[model samples]
Target: MISSPPKLREGLEVIRGMDDIPLIFDPVSGHYHRITRSAEALLGYLDGTRTRDDLVAYFSENARVDQARADAFSRQLDTFLAGLERSGLLEGSEQTEQGTGASPSAGGKRFRTSMLMPRVVLTRSLPTVLEPVARVLRALPARLIVVLATLGAVTGYAFGFHTLFTGTPGLRDLAGPAFLIATGVMLLIVLAHESAHALVAQYLKVPIRGLGVALLFYFMPVAYVDRTDAYRLRGRGGRVLLAMAGVLSDGWFCGVVGLVALNSSGLVQHTAAFLLGMQMFLLIVNLNPLMPSDGYTAVEAAAGLTNMRGRAFTLLRHTIRRQPLPEHLARFGTGARRWHVTYALASVAYGCFLAYAMFHTIPLSVDLALSVVGR
Candidate 1:
């Protein structure tokens, strides 16, 4: 029962999102909270000049509600304001008794980190360095770039694959120096892919926290840029573009290399063809929706959902066990329930298909490698 009018802390930014949804960003915590439209309206009145009773009276007058209904509304408003206070969005308010402070979500953790995917941050100043490039990209015709890149990728891959299976050099011919050259090119492609994500995020005014390298699953090395702040973006379009930027850059690289492979001969042709194949393989992995890849992120952004994979898998587990739905899930609307179940089943099926493909492809790949290395 705070008698004083609760004021929002200084430096909090409220951005309007899709469908007029409001998102409040707290720079200190580097987290953003999605709030309802009504909540946003209520926030406007909390300028340290109005108390809880004043809000209730305002609501009563506006809605033409009786005293009984107004009392109920007052209680609801209290709860909402209390939540905001706990989230550290209110000025001069302490967190809960536990002293752990409020978090961005119910999970109570801002970041998902694991030892299996350890990252070494390369630099925190990428935004400043990449600002000029981002501005240039923003100034260009985005639709034209997308169209050209898409068309080039399709044409180059068609010709490249034709050359690959028809009359290109054998694995023996592509060994040693050609192989090393292709590997170097593949590494550069990976760097460009990550840089594209960062650049798009910067263009959208999302904070680039860091650029880094990480060992995914404790083995596979990957370049990653921390664009988690993209979640704070107001529009779904910006978020989806940020997610797909890496894939687009990969397509552009493949397009260039694939065309080169189609026209060239000797070592250059072999190396470019090899690099194209490697890029295609990486694209497949990146675009697998069953995993937490770029494709999954894009889907989540498009649907304006969060933690879809986690929710889907949880629902799948409960269904398999014939157990009751968890409290949070039980609250889902009809459409959401169906979506979660469908995604879960689809993920399961896709995973099986991948396992089957790998089972058959691994032996062939090993044989190809052995032949190439002169074993």
Candidate 2:
């Protein structure tokens, strides 16, 4: 047995969820790999150990894997080891067989760091001043936030939306310095929007990995904060708050700007109308539950289920095929299965809306861009 700790690639981020699912992020590949608890324990043994046989023997003897599955794993342990090596997580491998170590139950789920758009960090991860902000926020009652957010939402729907769309700004409003100032303000608002998520997450004691802008689809730049650790928070409400933070921030900002725009006159009114419309549009977009946006995360929290959409889709497939649910799918409780089924139906309708929105928005964005440049 060449029992030496295998070389682990650097710059990989390891995170553990409250469910103990291990998420390994490869910065170089911009991919996140989620491995099961058994896989995690096996990988833990790879600390500078170069031999696969020793780890296999150790796993066979002392691993906390399910007893029913132990004999099966023992039979195919070598293939599992090989799968780990093929993932490029380890620097070197003594085994050459490909797709090794990929147990059906323990296999990794790979996500390319995003869902709708490709993300490349405009700035690398760094420390944030959000800790102090979180501290201040934590000192306040959670009830206060909920009340304020509810009130703001009610107010926005009642009056803010009307002001946002009633007085339409012409393309001329977006032609010159007026548009530039609005863009700058919107950027600042976006930064604040992402920071709100970070702050709420910090208040919940979730580690903030970093915040940066990413060029969404290689065109428009979007700001985002790494609040992936929010999953580690045990309280479902905490996770929901973290997910809803940015949406609440947008709502509040839009309400404030809309009220101000309504009270003022002349160019201030026109420009503010334009800004408020854009922000309101963004707020609605972020709150779309069918997308992988804040609304989706909040729904997941409410349902106390991670990967709700995936499970929902799986349930749909099984129902269509008239087959027994897979063992992994059986892990979901009765209530969770019901929720997944409901979400699945809503998702199909929302997905169709999203498709139409994307197709229609592209031409509008091009025309808007040309109008700004052409003028």
Query: Best TM-score goes to which candidate?
Result: 1
Q: List the residue pairs that clash in candidate 1.
A: none
Off by over 4 Å in 2: 1-16, 20-71, 76-83, 88-116, 124-126, 165-180, 217-220, 304-375
lDDT of residue 80 for candidate 2: 49
List TM-scores for all candidates, in order: 0.73, 0.64
Candidate 1, 65: how far from true, in Å?
Answer: 1.5
RMSD of each: 5.5, 7.7
Q: Give the per-residue lDDT of model 2 (tens digit) for 246-300.
A: 8877777777777867787666676677678678778776887766678888887
Residue-by-residue lDDT tens digits, candidate 1, 297-343: 88888988766776787787887899998555777898888888898
List runs of model 1 lying over 4 Å from the truth: 1-7, 46-58, 71-75, 91-119, 167-181, 214-221, 231-236, 263-270, 304-330, 341-375
lDDT of 2 at 87: 67
Q: Estimate the TM-score for candidate 1.
A: 0.73
Give the Å shift of residue 372 in candidate 2: 7.3
lDDT scores for all predictions?
Answer: 0.73, 0.64
TM-score of 2: 0.64
